[model samples]
Structure formats: C-alpha cells, structure tokens
Target: MKALVYNAPYDVSIENVPDARIEQPNDALVQITTTNICGSDLHMYEGRTAVERGKILGHENMGIVEETGPGVTRVQPGDRVSVPFNIACGTCRNCLSGWTAFCLRVNPVEGMDGAAYGYANMGPYDGGQAELLRVPHADVNLLELPPGTEHESDFTMLSDIFPTGWHGTELAGQQAGDSVAVFGAGPVGLMAAHSAMLRGASRVFVVDKEADRLALAESIGATPVDFTQGDPVEQILEATGGRGADCGVEAVGYQAHDQSGQEHPELVLDNLVKAVRTTGGIGVVGVYVPEDPEAADEGARHGRVAFDYGTFFTKGQRMGTGQCPVLRYNRGLRDLVIAGRARPSFLVSHELGLDEAPDAYRHFDKRDEGWTKVLLHPGQ
Candidate 1:
C-alpha cells in the first residue's frame, strides 16, 4: 500500500506501508477512493503537535467498503460510505447523547474522551489517506451514502469540514435575517460562510488577508474583509452599520495571525468579541490544542490565550467551542448535497493522486496561491 507518512516538520512522503485490514470484530475494511489534506493537518505538518513519524496523515475520507467483519451487519461489501474523522463507539454516554466528538470509548489515553484519525493525541487509529483504511465500529461510525451517489468530491467533505462548518453556524445560534461575521477565509471558514448563506443570513462577512481566499468568499455572496488593509473589526462594523454583526465565528483557531502576518494566538478570539454585537452568540470551530511547544509565547505554549473575557462578560455574549460531532450533522448535510442545494467541491483547488500528496502537503502548508484545498484520490 502507498500512503502519505509524516517524516518531520514540513516533510511528508509517499511510501510503501502495510495494507490496512480489519483488526476488530466490528470493523470494516474500506478501499479509500477520496481523502483530503485538512488545514488541521498543517498543525502537525508544521511541528505544532506531537504526532509521531510514519503515521498516515489524512482524516477526511470516503470510499467503498471492501469487506466487513462478522459483527458488522448494517453495511456490507461494495457499499459506499463516508468515515467521520471522529471515531466513536455508539455505546458511550456521549455518543448516546449526540456528542460523538466526546465519545468516552475511542481514545486509548486514559481521561481523554475524544479520538480522530491521523491526529496527534487522538488515538492509535491510522487515517484513510492510503489505498485502504480500517474503520472501527463500522456500523456506527461509517455513514452509508445513497446508492449511485456520484458526487464523490462533495460527499467527501461530509467527513469533516462540511459538517464542521454547519456546526459553527448552529453553535452561533444564527437565525434567518441575521448577519454573520466569520474570521478567516480558509476552507472551513469559507464553508462557514456558505452555510450561513444557505441558512438565510442577511449578510455574511468573511475576513482574511489572502486575495484568492477573499475572492472565493465573495463569490459566494459574502462580503470580504482583507485585514491587511485595515482593522477587520472596523471593516465588519462598518459593513454592519456599526451595530456589529448579529453573530461572529472564529474559524482561524490558535494559528491566527495579525495584519502584519505575525502569529497572534488570541487574535481571532479578540476580533470576534469586538465584532459581534452585544448579547450575540459566537461559535468557534477552530482547532485549539491544550499545548503548542512551538508557540511564540509562554502563555500560548500552555494553550492559554490572553482573551478579553472582561469585555465578553460585559457584553453578555455567549460562546460555544469544540470539535464538531459529524454524526449530528453529516446526514442532513449529505442530503443537502444529494439534493443539489450545496456544492462543497468548489473549495477544492487541487486534485492530485496519492503519489502527489507529499508535494500537495508542502504547497498547502505554505498556504500558497491557488492552493485553497487539496483532495487526494488514492485510486487515481
């Protein structure tokens, strides 16, 4: 099998690896057709996380089930499915309550409640970036796609960013006719803007410095705010008639940067607090770890940011932050794709074979021009 393996900081390679096979009674073996290189993967690629070398580096995955364990009854060979990045056992208390991201039974680390494929500190599960992948708790974790579903590129997003983007809007309590200010125009942030528009937002403002990304956001009818030109908060406020947006979304996470391109761990949080109206809600879908040994400051190294909690409290604003539980939203989002209401593939800027994954990682990691998103087709 050929797969992308993390070698070191800013380095990854396509190397021959052992074939993935079902290791548990409830597992299924999937022949991966499409996988993605996520922005979160860049955290590990940049040496910001403690991910081990030789680990396969993909999480957004979808494919056809090649085989199933004896215990798997819901799906069988030849069935197409999308594997959520969060691997959950259906019997856990959190899973039963619709919080699959916090499932208590997946992570091997004691006291850790969540797990993700190819993610640092998540679990021992290998990702689906290769020709094959093993899916644990197959019946519960694999979303069976509609028969003959041909939108592989679009459906592939259901595994992570699509649902995650929808979750952001849901967390912000966005209502029809409301205005939303989303910080960051990365794939997830763009998806958040698309979700906001799909849900009837009166106005959507997407903030970022990249001209291409901002243009993509504007293509979807979102007002683009290039922070490099001026204060993003002021720009958003000006667009919102000075009342501030009805809601704000933080999609840039811990790697947020200021106008000068310096890493400011709390930049998005502070910007969201000031950009959202009083009593409005804020949803954060960005990845923020408890520790980043490569952080620019001692406080951020421990995952502590100097946020404006005093101002947030005074404004009576509410905030929701965490990983998105794909199970809670993937099905509905998938239907939206099936019905042609959404087209997430528009974010995919590059489609490469499995062999090109290493170079793709480097290009995407640099946030290079025309590299908004990269989708890897293992079967290509």
Candidate 2:
C-alpha cells in the first residue's frame, strides 16, 4: 500500500507500506478514498510534536468500508463513511456522554486522548493517507454519508475541519446578530468565520497578513483585515464603533504574533481581548505547543508564551481553547452539509493524489500562496 510517511522535519513522502488489516474484532477495514493534509499534520511535519518517523500522516479521512468485524453493526461493506479524527468507543462513559475525543477506552496503550489514522497526539493507529485504514471501534466511530451527496471532496472535510469550525463557534457561543472577529485567515480560521456567519453573526471580520487568504475570507462574506498593514485591534474597534466586537475567535494558535513577527500563541489572545467587547467570549482553535529543541525555537522549557492577562481580566471576557470534540458536533454538522447550509469545501484550494502529498505538505506548511487547504485522494 502507498502511504504518506514522515521521513524527517520538512520531509514527507508517499512510500509503499504494509497493508492495513483488521486487528481487532471491533475493527473495520476501509479503502480510503479521500483524506486531507491538515494543519495539525504540520505540527509533526515541523517537528513541533513527538510524532515518530515512518508513521503515516493524515487524519481527516473519508472512504468506503471494505470489510468489517463481526461486532460491527452500524456499517457494513460497500457503505461509504466519513471517519472522525478522534477514534472512540461508543460504549465508553465519556463517549456515552458525547465526549468522544476524551474516550476512556480508545487508546489503552497510549493512555487517554487517542486519535485516528495518522496523528501526533493520537496513538499507534495508522492514518488514512494510505490506500486503506484500519478503524478500531468501527461501529462507534464511522459516520455514514447520506445517499444523495456526490461531492466527496466536501464530505471529506466534514471528517475534521467543518465540525471543528462548528465546535469553535459553539464554544464562543455564537448567536445571530452578534459581531465577531476571527484571527488568522487559514483554512480553519476561514471556516470559523464562515461558521460564525451561518450562526447569524452580523459581521465576521477575518484577520491575517496573507493577501490570498484575506481575499478568500472576503469571498466568504467576512471583512478582511491584514495584520501586516496596521493594528488589527484598532481596525476591529473602529469597525465596531470602539466597543469592540461582540465576540472574537483565535484561530492562529501558536503561530500567533510577537515583537519579532514570529510565532507567538499569545497574540491571538491579546487580539481577542482587545477586539471583543466587555463580557464577550472567545474561542481558540489554533494549534499551540512547546517548541522542539532540535527543529525550531528550541530554547523554551515551559510551553509558556506571551499573553495579556491584564487586558483579558480588565475586559471581563470569557475564553475557550482546545481540540474540537468532533464526535459531539459532527452529526449536527453533517445535517448542515446535507442540507447545503454549510459548504466547507469552499476552503479547499487543491486536490491531488496521495503521491503528491510531499509537495502538498511543503506548500501548505510554508503557507505558500493559494494553498488554503489540500485534500488527498489516497487511491488516486
């Protein structure tokens, strides 16, 4: 099977790997049709996480069930499904309560916080960036696509980014008629802004220094703010009549802002504090973590970065940050996609075969022009 393997920092390639077969009675073997090179994959690609070499690297996946274990009842062979990024056991206490990402029974070998396919924080599961994937707890984790949908590219994103965007909006308590500001104009950030609009935000301001991304944001009905030009906070405040926005979402993660114009997760927090009105809330969906000693910015011991707690405290604002619990919201989001209310596929700028994954990763990781989102069709 051809799979995308992490060779080293800034090095990924499509190599022939061993075939994936069902290893457990609850497992399902899926012939992966589509997958995406996610922002989270960049964490491992950049050597920011402890993702081991030779691991397949992709999480957002959708495909057809080639075979299923005897215990699998929810889906059978020939059924199309979109697997959530988080692998969960539906019968677990956490999963029963709708917290699938925190499932207690999923990653027994890695402790808690298990993930599917290829992922850094995820366990030893092989990702779907290959020709096929073995899905543990298949009955619990796979989402079957509806009968009439044809845009596989769009449905593939529902496996991760769309639901994640919805999670960010839900975390921020997005409501109709409220004005909102979202930092970062990347795929997730743009999706967050789009989600805000779908939830009825009166105004959605998307901030980023990239001209292409800002333009994409505008195409989706958001007011674009380029951080390189001037103070985004002032622009947001002025746009909102000096009271700031009703809510703000930080989507840049650790690739935030700093004095040197480098990666700083704290800048998003500062912008959220300054751009959000008093008592407003903020949702952060960007990836943030300690720097790797060997790859980039290795000096820091603590995962600590700069932040303006005083401003946040003074504004009396509420904030939420973490990984999106996709299982909790994917069902509802699926309905939205089925109803044509959310077109998250709009964020996808390129679609290529799994063989093109190395180049895709390079371009997307470098934040290259027109590389908003790249979906990989594994069998292509």
Candidate 3:
C-alpha cells in the first residue's frame, strides 16, 4: 500500500508501505475511501509536534468496512462509516462519560489519554491516508452513515472538524440572539461561525487576516473582521457598541498575536477576553500543547504561553479548551448536514489524490495559495 510518510520538517511523500491488517479481535479493517489533511497534521509535518518518521498521518477519515472482527456487532462488512480522530477504548471511564479524547485507554505514544491516528501527540497508530486502515474498537468508534445517502463527500468532515467546531461553540454557550466573535477564519473557524449561526446567534464576527477566508465567512452570514488592518478587540467592541460580544470562540490556538505585533498563542485568548463582554464565556478548539519546549517557531511552543489571566479573571469569563469529543456530537451534526441546515463541505478548497499529498502539505502548512482545506482521495 502507498501511504503518506513523514520524512522530515517540511517534507512528506507518498511511499509504499505494508497494507494494514486487523490486529485485534474487536477491530475492523476499513478500505479507506476518503481522508482529510488537517491543520493538526501540519504540526507534525513541520516538526512542531513529535511523531516518528515513516508513520502514516491522516485522522479525519470516512470509509467502508471491508471486514470486521467476530466481536464486532454494531457494524458489519460493507457498512459505510466515519472514524473519529481519537483512538479510544470504549470501556474506559472517560470514554463512558463522553470524553473520548481523554480516554484512559488507547495510549498515543505512552501513558494514559489514549492516542490518535497520524497525529503529532497521538500514539503509534497508523493513519488512514493510505488505502486501508485498521480500526480498533470498531463497534464504538465507527459512526454508521444514514442509509441511502449518496453524497458522502461532505459528510466526511463529521470525523473531526465539523463536530469539533460545534463542540467549541457549544462550550462557549452560544444562544439565539447572542453575538459572537470567532478568532480565525480557517476551516475550523468557519465551522465555528456556522455552528454559531445554527444556534441562532444574532450576529457573528469572524476575525481573520486572510481575505479569502474572511470572504467565505461573509458568504456564510458572518461579519468578517480583517485582523491585519487594525486591532481585533477594537473591531469587535465597535461592532458590539462597547458591550463586547456575548461569546468569543478562540479557534486560532497558541499561534495567536499580541497587540504589539508579536505572535503568541496566549494573545488569541487575551484578544478574546478583550473582545467579549464581562461574564461572557470562551470556547477554544485550537490545538495547544504542553510539549515542544524548544519549538523554534512561535506556533509550535508548549502550553506555558503567556496570556492576560488577570483580565480574564477580573471579567469573570468562563473558558473551555481541549480536543473535541467528536463522537458525542457526531450524530446531531450529521443530521444537520443531512437536512441541509449546515454545509461544512464549503470549507474544502482543494481535492487531490494520495499521490498529490506532498504538495498539499506544503500549501496547507504554509497556508498558501487559497488552501483552506485539503481532502485526499485515498483510492484515486
């Protein structure tokens, strides 16, 4: 099988690798039809996040079950399914409580908190960027697609980004008639704004420096705040008449910016704090790590970044952050997509075959040339 192999910093290429096989009794071997190249993958590709060389690197995936273990009962051969990015053991205490991302089982590299396929901080599980994927705990991990659905292309996002965005907005406590400011206009940011609207937000201001992404935000009924032009806090405050937004979702993670034109992950949260009204809540879905102490770039640093904690505490603002419990929210998001209430498919800007993954990595990692989201067709 040909899989995308991480060779070095800023280098990934398609290389022939062994075909995946079922290794556990509860596992199912999936013939991957569609997989995604996520922004998180870029963390590993750029050497920001630690991952072993030659490991396959894809997580947001949807495919067909080719075969299932005898213990599997929830799904069977030939069923279409979406695999959540987290590789969790279904029986763990955390898994039972709907926190699959922090499952006590399925270690990523080692220890607890389990692992993710083809992810930086995730365990040794191989990714689905290849022709096949071995899905452990198949019964609990696979979400069966609705019967008779044809356009599985868009629904593929249910594996991660869609549910993640929805979860972030939900954490922020967005409600009908409330205003929101989402920092970042990337795929997740756009999805967050879309989720905010689905919850009936009165007005959504999406702050981004990218013109194309901000335009997409406007097309989806969100007000685009170009962060490069001026202060995002001032923009949000002016837009909200000095009361600030009711909720602010920080989608940009640790690579945020401070007012002095310096890049810092904590800057994003600070701006969010400055933008939202007192007592408002914040939801963060962006990736921030406690790993990588010597990260050369500002975006790839550890969790100890500086932020305005004093201001946040003084404002009495609540905050939520971490990986999204995708399985907990996948069903409702799928219903939204099936009913046309939400269309995450609009985020896909480029579609390429597995062979084109190297170039895709470069464009997406650098965030160059209108590359918002890149989808890889594994069997193409």
Candidate 4:
C-alpha cells in the first residue's frame, strides 16, 4: 500500500508501505476514500512535535469497510463509515462518560490518557492517508454513512472538524440570539463560525487577515474582522457595541502570529480574553503543547504562555479547553448534512491526490492564496 510517510522537518512523501491489517479482534479494515491533511499535521511535518520519522500521518478519515473481525457486530463489511481521529477503547471510564478524547485505555505511554492515529505522542496506530486503514473498536468507533456517494465531501467532515467546530461552541456555551467572536479564520475557525450560525447565534464574527478565509467566513453569514486593518480585539469589541462578544473561541493554536509573521504563543489567548464579555464563556479548541523548544517566545519554551490571568480572574470568565469528543456530536451533525442544513464542504478549496500532499503542505503551511482547505484522495 502507498501511504504518506513523514521523513523530517518540512518533508513528507508517498511511499509504498506494508499493508494495514486487522490486528485486534474488534477491528475493521477499511478501504479509505477521503483523508484530510489537517493543520495539526503541519505541527509534525515541521518537526515541532516528537513525531518520529517513517510514521504515516493522517487522521481525518472516512471510507468503506472491506472486512471486520469476528467480534465486530455493529459495523460490517461493505458499510461506509467515518473514523474519529481519536483511537479510544470503548470500555474506558472516560469513553463511558462521553469524554472519548480522554479515554484511559488507548495510549500506552504513561500519563497520556488520550490517543489518536498518526499524531505526536498519541499512540501506535497508523493513519488512513493511504489505500487502507485498520480501525480498532470498530463497533463503537465507526459512524455508519448512508448508501451512495451523495455528500461525500460534506460527510467526510464528520470525522473531525465538523464535530470539533461544534465542540468549540459547546465549550463556549453559545446560545441562540447571542453574539460570538471566533479568533482565526482557518478551517477550524471557519467551522466554529459555521457552528455558531447552526446554533442560531445572532451575530458571528471571524477575525483573520486572509482574504480567502475571511471571504469564506462571510459566505457563511459571519462578519469578517481583518486583523491587518487594525486591532482585532478592538474590531470585535466595536462590532459588539463595546461590550465585547457574549462568547469567544480560540481556533489558532500556539503557533499564532501577527501581520509581520512574528510568532506569539500567547497572542490569541490574550485577544480572546479581551474580545469576550466579562463572565462570558471562552472555548479553546486550538492546539497548545506542554513544550515547544522551537518557539519564538523565551517563556513559552516549556509550553507555558504569558496568559492574562489577572484580567481573566477579575472578569470571572468561564473556560473550557481540550480536544473535541468526536463521537458525541458526529451523529447529529451527520443528520444536519443529510437534511441539507449544514455544508462543511464549503470550506474545501482544493482536493488533490496523495502524491500532491507535500506541495499542499508547503502552500498551506505558508498560508498561500486560495488554499483554504484540502482533501487528499489516496486512491485517485
């Protein structure tokens, strides 16, 4: 099988690797149809994380089940399914309590509770950016898709960003008629804005400098705030009548920067603290690590940011931070797509084959024009 393998910093290529097979009794082998190259993957591709060489690197996946183990009862051969990024054991305490991202039985490394395919320090499971993928705990992990090829692009999002975007709103406690200000306009940020609209937010503000991404935000009825024009926090506040947004989301991870491309690890968090209303909730769906030896900030080398704890304390703001529990919302979001209510595929700007992944990574990492979202078809 040909899979996308990570070689070193700023490098990845398609290579003929060993075939993926069912290794567990509850596992299912899938013929992958669509696998995404996530912004998170750039972290590993750029050597920011501890991700080793020679590992397959994709997690956002959906495909048709080719075969299933004897222990798998619900999911079977020939069923189309979406695999969540998290590789969780269904019987764990965290999984039972709806926190599948923190499942205790997945990652074997000490002190790490959660696990994901092809992620840094997550687990040993390989990813689906190839012709085949082995899904563990198939009965509980795979979300069945309807028959036919309808909504293939949209349904593909159910594996991660759609639910993750919805999870950002869930963390911020967004409600109908309330105002939301989402920091950043990347895929996840755009999805967060879309999720805000889905939940009936009276006003949704997306902050970014990119014309293409902000245009996509506006296409979904969100007001675009161009940080390059002026102070993004002030723009959000002014748009909210100076009271600030009722809730806010941090979609840019620790790699956040300004117009001049200077890396500021704490920039988005501080901006969110100022953009959101006092006592209003804030959700952080962006990636933040415990260590970044390559970070530009001297204080952030140990993964500690210069957060605005003083104002956060005085404002009494509520905060929720972590990875999305993809299983919790995939079903409902899938129905929305089936009903023609949500179209996450709108954010997709490019769909290329697996061979083009390395170039796509370079363009996306540089935030090149018109490269908003990309979907890699392994079998193409």
Candidate 5:
C-alpha cells in the first residue's frame, strides 16, 4: 500500500507501507476510494502542529468496506461508507449525548477525551489516504451511503468539511432570512457559505484575499469581500446599512492574517466581534491550537490572542467554538446530497492519484492559484 507519510515541515512523500488490517473485534478494513487533503492537514504539513514524522496524514475519507470483524453487524463487506474524521466509541457518555467529537473511550492516552485518525495528539489510528484503512468501531463510525449513490466526489465531503461547515452556521444561530458574514473562503468557508444559503440566509458575505477562492464563493451565491482592498468589517457593514451582519462565522481560525501576509492570530475573532450585529451569535469552526511552535510571535505560540473581549461583552453576543461533531450532522447532509440539493464537489479543484499527493500538498499548503481543494484516488 502506498501512503502519504509526513517527513518534516513542508515535506511529505508517498511511500509503500503495509496494508491495514482489522486489529479490533469491532473493526472494519476499508479499501479507500476517495480521500481528501484538508486545510487542517496543512497544519501538520507546515510543521505548525506537533505531528511526528512517518505518520500517514489524511482524515477526510470514504471507501468500500472490504472486510468486517465478527462484531460488526450493521455494516458488511462490500458496503460503501463514509468515515467520520473523529474516531468514537458508540457507548461513551459523550457519544450518548450527541457529542461524538469528545468521546472518552477512543483515545488511549489518559486525559485525552477525543481521538482522530492521522491527527497529532489525537490517537494512534492511521488515516485513510491509502489503498487500505483500518476503521475501529466500524458500525458506529461508518455511515453507509444510499444504494447506488453515484456522486462519490460529493459524498466524500460528508466525512468532514460538509458537516463542519453546517456546524459553523448552526453555531452562529443563522436563521431563515438572516444575514451571515463568513471569514475565509477556503473549502470549509465555502461550505459554510453554502450551508448558510441552504438554510435560507437572506444574504451571505465571504471575506478572503484570494481571488480564486472569492470567485468560487461568488459562484455559490455568496457576496465576496476581498480584504486585500479594504477592511472586511467595513465592507460587511456598508453592505448591511451599517448595522453589521446578523451573524458572523470565523472559519479562518488562528492562522488568520491580513492582505499583506502578516500573521495575526486573532484577526478573524476581532473582525467577527465588530462585523456581527449587537446581540447576534458568532460561530468559530476554524482550528485554534493552544500551542503553535511556529507562530509569528511568542504570545501566539502560547495560544494567547489579544481579542476584543470588551467589545464582545458590550455587544451582548454569544459564541460557540470547537471541533464539529461530524456524526451529528452527516446523515441529514447526506440526504441533501442524495436529493441533489447540495453539491460540495464544486470546491474540488484537483483530483490526482496517490502518487501525486506530495506535490498537491505543496501547492495547497502555499494556497496557490486554482488549488482550492485536492482529492486523492488511492486505488487509481
């Protein structure tokens, strides 16, 4: 099996690795068909996260199950399934409460309540960016696709970004006819804007400096705000008659920056605080780490951002932040796809074989033009 292995900062290679096998009684072995290179994966690829060398690095995955353990009764061999990025046990306290992202029984390390495949500080499970992947707790973790589901490229997004994007709007308390301002126009941000449109947002504004990404957002009916030209908050306010958007979503996370390429960890948060209307809700779906060794400053390295708490409190705004519970929203979103109501594959800019993953990583990490998203076909 050929897998994308992390070597060091700004380096990854496709190497022949041993095929994954069923290691647990509840496990299933999946022959991967479509896997994605996520923006979150770029954190590891850029050496911002503490991911070690030689580890496989993909989590957004969907494939055909080839074998299942005796305990797996619901899903069988030959079923097409989408694997959530989070690895959770079906019977944990958190799982029972619909918070699968914080499952207590999956991570082997003490004090760590959550786990994910191929993620640093998550667990020992390898990712699905190869010919074979080992899926633990298969029945609970895998979502079987509807029979004859032909949109593999679109269905593949249910594993992570689709649900994550929906979760962002949910966090922001977006309602029908409400206006939403979203920061960042990456895959997740684009999905967030699409979700807002699906949920009936009257107006959606996507802020980003990249021209290609902003164009993609516009194609999806979102108003594009190029921060390179002017202040994003001012643009949103000007468009909204100076009252600000009803809600705002910070999808750029801690790596946020200005048009000049200067890293400002709290830029989005401050922008959201001011861009959202008073007493409105704000959702943060972007990744913000407690420790970023490669941060631009010592304060950011320690996860300290000079946020505008005073303004946030005075505005009476509420916020929701953390990783998305993929399982909670995947089923409903899948149905929307099956009904042809949503097509996330529009964000995919490149589809390459497993051997081309190394180059794809480089281009995506740099946010190169026309490289909005990359999907890898391992079995190709």
Candidate 6:
C-alpha cells in the first residue's frame, strides 16, 4: 500500500507500507478514496506535536468499505462511508452520552481518554491517507454516504472540518440575528463563518492576514478582518458599533501569529476575549497542546501563555473548548450537503493524488497562496 509517512519536521513522503486489514471482529477495511490534508496535520508536519515517524498522516477521510467483519452490522462491504477522526467504542460511557470525542474506552494509553487515527498520542490506529484503512468499531464510527461519488468533495468534509466548524458555533452559543467574529481564516475558520451564516448570524467577521483566505471568507458572505491592517478586535468592534460582536470563535489554535507574523500562543484567545460582547459566549476549536518544544515563545514552550483571564472574568463571558465530537453534528451536516444547503468543497483549492501529498503538505503548511485546502485521492 502507498501512504504518506511523516519522517521529521517538514518531511513527509509517499512510500510503500504494509497493507491495512481488518484487525478485529467489529472492524471494517476501507479502500480510502478521498482524504484531505487537514490544518491539524500541520501540527505534526511542522514538528509542533510528537507525531512519531512513519505514521500515516491524514484524518479527514471517506471511502468505500471494501470489506467488513461479521460483527459490523450497519456498515457493509461496498458501502461508501465517511469515518470520523475520533475512534470511539460504541458502548463507552462517553460515547453513550454523545461525547464521542472523550470516549473513555478507546485510547490505550493509561491517562488518555479518547482516540483518533494517524495522530500523535491519540491511539495506534492507522489513518486513511493511504490506499486502505482499518477501521475499528466500524458501526459506531462509519457514516454511510450516498452510494456514488457525487459531492465527493463535500462528503469528505464530514469527517472533520465541517462538523468541527459547526462545533465552534455551538460552543459560542450563536443565535440567529447575533453577530459573530471568527479569528483565523483557515479552512476551519472559514467554515465557522459559513456555519454562522447558515444559522442566520446577522454579521460574520473572519480575521486573518492572508489575502487568499480573507478573500475566501469574503466570498462566503463573511466580512474579512485582516490583522495586518490593525487590531482585529478593534476592527470587529468598529463593525459592531463598538458593542463588540455577539459571539466569537477562535479557530487558529496555539501556533497563532501576531500582526507582524511572529508566533504568539495566546494571540487568538486574547483577541476573542476582546472581540465578543461582555456577556457573549466564545468557542475555541483550535488545537492546543500541553507543550511545544519548537515554540517561538518561551512561555509557550511550556504551554504557558499570558491569557487575559482577568478580563475574561470581568466581562462575564463564557467559553467552551475541546475537540468536536463528530457524531453529534455530522449526520445533520451531511444532510445539509445532500440537500444542497452547504458546499464546504468551496474551500478546497487543490485536488492532488496520493503521490503528491508531500508537496501538498509543504505548500499547505507554509500557508501558501491559493492553498486553503488540499484533498488527496488516495487511490489516484
């Protein structure tokens, strides 16, 4: 099998790997058709996370189930399915409660609570960035898509960004007619803005310095707030008549940068705190780890940044932070795609083959022009 393997910082390659097969009775073997190089993959690609060498590097995945174990009842061979990144056991306490992201029975690591494919410290599961993927708890995690490849690009998003973006809005408690200010114009950020629009936000502001991403945000009916022009919070406030936005979403995560392009771990958090109304809610869907050995800020190296907790407390704002439980939102989001109410494929800027994944990773990691999102067809 050919798959993208992470060797070191900024080094990934397509190499022949062992074939993926069913490892458990509840498992299914999927022939990966479409997978995306997600923003989260950059964390490992940039050496910001402890993603081990030789690990397959993709999570946003969808494909045809080539085979399934007898224990898998819902998903069957030849069924097109989208597998969520979080690999949860169906009977776990957290999974039963709809908190699939925090499933207690998946991660083998003693202290870890959840599991994911092809991620650092998440689990031992191989990812879908290859010709085939072995999916455990198949019935619990596989989302059956329409039989063919119609909306292939859109259905591929059901695995991650689309639902996670909607999770940002859910955490922020966004209501129809309320205004939203989203920090970062990456794929997730753009989706957050788009989700806000679908839910009827009166105004949506996307903050980013990248001309390409900001333009994409604007194309989605969001007001673009380029940080290089001025303080993003200030720009958002002015647009909201100085009252601040009714809600805010932080999609940039820990490796966030300032206006001058210097890395600032707390930049987005501070901006979100200041950009929303005093009593408004904020949702943080950005990835933040306990430590980053390559962090530009010394404090961030130890996962300690000077967050404005005092200001946050004074403002009486509420915040929700964590990974998105894809099960909670994907079904509805998938229906939105089928009904033509959502088209997340609009964010995909490149469609490359599995062999070209390394270069795609390089360009996407640098935040290069017109590289908002890159979808990889593994079998191509």
TM-scores, all candidates, are: 0.99, 0.95, 0.95, 0.99, 0.98, 0.98
lDDT for each residue of candidate 5 in 253-330, tens digit (9 for 90 to 100): 888888888889988999999999999999999999888987888998998988999999999999998899999999
lDDT of 6 by residue, 81-147 (tens): 9999999997878899999999998898777788999999898888889999999999999999999
Q: What is the C-alpha RMSD of each candidate to the true structure, in Å?
A: 0.9, 2.0, 2.0, 0.8, 0.9, 0.9
Give every collision pair in model 4.
none
Residue 162 displacement in candidate 3 (angstroms): 0.4
Candidate 4 C-alpha lDDT tens digits along 175-249: 899899999899999999999999999999999999999999999999999999999999988887899999999
Candidate 2 residue spans exceeding 4 A from truth? 108-112, 147-149, 257-260, 290-300
**What residue pairs clash in candidate 5, if any at all?**
none
TM-score of predicted structure 6: 0.98
Deviation (Å) of 242 in candidate 1: 1.0
Clash numbers, per candidate: 0, 2, 5, 0, 0, 0
Off by over 4 Å in 5: 147-149
lDDT scores of the candidates, listed in order: 0.92, 0.82, 0.86, 0.92, 0.93, 0.92
Q: Between candidates 5 and 6, name the one with more favorable lDDT.
A: 5
lDDT of 1: 0.92
